[model samples]
Target: MIIGAQSALAQIIDIPNPLGPEGLTIPGLVAKIATWLLEIGSVIAVIVILWAALVFMTSGGNKERVTQARQTLWYAIIGLIVLLLASGVAELIKNFLTGNYN
Candidate 1:
């Protein structure tokens, strides 16, 4: 009985493939996700920049607050740099895999 039930369940189940057939391959998927992340990251970076500017403006001439705001701004810049590089790398990988890396 158990064996018959297991066979019936297996036959009724159809698993979908995320990286095969009609969908994007692994590298292609990664590149697509990276592109989306870059777009989202750009928006987030802009918000962070605005927040950091607000912090600086409200620092009231305090050295500690000014330094904190500066650090936050710098960190945002660095995060953008990293995001760009990562997206670039993903593109390169996708191109190389697709044989379009001339």
Candidate 2:
């Protein structure tokens, strides 16, 4: 059952699941999902940055390609910025929800 799986996962993570309880707490779920998303986002962002750099390096003086690479690099940088902001926001939300602020 889904409940059994949730409880098992909760135990593995050391989050409590009262022997007969239903599910993990909302904040715990949010934190777990946010952590996954942030990790994926960071990996994608790094790949994009590398791809953009490769494009820029291989442009070979072609104005259009150079421009395209520049645009791609700028977009990747923006995406990284957004991801960084989201990471901070996620931490804030998780901390607020769990009352674990510093």
Candidate 3:
């Protein structure tokens, strides 16, 4: 009967699953996703910076416009810093999992 076969299968020991190519693991998966996010963020940052540069160039010495442009640039710089920190943390996690310190 099916129940008998199920019981027999349950008696067998559990075997670990094999990892496919590219060394898939929890940390590896996290690092891969983080890298992807970093790439996307970098692209967005570039776009924002370029937009800010264009704004500044078009401000034509107007104080208010220049202030807005500078603010945009400042925000972009903060975003870049946060993204860099996140990337560093991802790298740290990857290294820790790989047993590579310093």
Candidate 3 Cα deviation (angstroms), residue 13: 37
Q: Could you give candidate 2's per-residue lDDT for residues 18-77 as a string of tens digits?
A: 522676776667667778888898899889888888988998988988899889888888
Each prediction's number of clashing residue pairs:
0, 0, 0
| Model 3: ten consecutive residues of lowest lDDT | 1-10
Q: Which stretches of candidate 1 lie over 4 Å from their true place?
A: 1-28
Candidate 3: tens digits of C-alpha lDDT, residues 21-47: 555988667666778899999889889
Q: Estimate TM-scores for all models.
A: 0.69, 0.69, 0.69
| Tens-digit per-residue lDDT, 15-98, candidate 1 | 988666788866678667777889999899989988999999999999998998999999999998998898788778768877
Stretches of candidate 3 above 4 Å error?
Answer: 1-23
Score candidate 2 by lDDT: 0.80
